[model samples]
Target: MDAAQHISIYSSGNRQPDYSPLQSTLDRLKKRTEENKVTINHTNTVVMHFCTSSQAVAHPQLSVGAHSLQLVQSTRLLGVTVDDRLSWKQHVINIVRTASYKLYMLRRLKSLGTPAKELRDVYTAFTLPTLMYASPAWSSSLTLTQQQQVERTQKRACRIILGPAYDGYDNALTILSLPRLSERHREALGKFGRGLLCHPCHQHFLPPDAPPPRCATRHINKLVPIRAPKTDRYKNSAIPSIVHMINSV
Candidate 1:
């Protein structure tokens, strides 16, 4: 697929009542796609998920090459399920559902007298990845209940791997050399911040720092953006969390 052919538009707030611009843009895209010999599959449904904080606004009737796209409550984008609210609740729920099923399989294996090392390996290979996949992007938005739900999955995995002797969840995690889910989320955000500092593409947005000392052969300078005024939580979550973590260090 030609990367340039894929276009995405983001509109914010419920106050804007105009839809003329969006309709016009879609019309141009439809015409361009036709020029590029792209055929629209009218039989298939195209979903347009409108994300909002409150009740949905009225969407203008939209059609592309004889196919009218339907507005949906939620949709999957690049493997993550994004809902209308942008709360990430749906994504978290879906991950928990998947992790719970995986835990069931792990518990069954445990009953079969599987070795602790092997079970730990399985949990690390499967369950942890599921819980932590793209977590830095969504973890900050999770509610207390949702965070607990995700944490419980890991706690269970730790218990299974550490055997029945460990008395507390903390102890089990300590023995496993693992941090709590929340702490891990912060760590991931910190790492992401450092990665951005090291990348040339992000240098434009990152605040500049003083020049390195003359004696210092190598200087590691951490650059983080100043926090903007608080507004909507879901908007630009990753960068702000990254900034917070970087400033703390």
Candidate 2:
């Protein structure tokens, strides 16, 4: 099975970063691949440097053997687009565009006298998956505008399905027995949190459980909240956001 590998290099506190260690690691990897008679695809290999600082900083020039890897601002991994800044804006736009296109098929079906129930099923099977794919990873980080942008696609789908009787987005959801996109995102996060608790491999990703109170209290069951994040990006990241949700319940 082919897979992409990610290597993270951290610098000592407040010190100028070093690339020598990363370069050495790459050399060893190249050696191992050579021993196995596997050729590395230089063109597909690229570097993405992640940092929160707004100021421009010099990037390291990294090479594997004779091939110098290109630097990219963003790349797709496992169908999710991740930018160096981790803002998730580009990812949202891409999914929204794709979902909107899928709505065209729904329109074509409607014009053919398809039943409303079947059209709803088509939307669920074809378009909704595009919007909800990997939602837990990026949903909490979405700006209000981005969230609205995604919701519009569903609203359009509602109009296409209900035709003249469509009232509004919320009312249509109630009539169709469908949850709002934002509500679905929250549900996805909660389900993912439960899965983390049940799976041994993912348990390590969860924050530590709250210490037992000296005297029992109603809140004793909550997991410990993470330390206050230094940036909004970190605060709204999947792990921290999910911890907040779990504790609130």
On lDDT, the candidate that comes out on top is 2
State in Å the error of residue 216, model 1.
5.1
Model 1 — which ten-residue stretch has the worst lDDT? 210-219
Model 1 Cα lDDT, one tens digit per residue, 205-230 = 44566222233545545444555646
Error of 1 at 182 (Å): 1.7
Candidate achieving the largest TM-score = 2
TM-score of 2: 0.89
Q: Which residue pairs clash in candidate 1?
A: none
Off by over 4 Å in 2: 1-15, 209-220
How does residue 109 of candidate 2 score in lDDT?
93
lDDT of 1 at 130: 83
- Full-model lDDT, candidate 1: 0.71
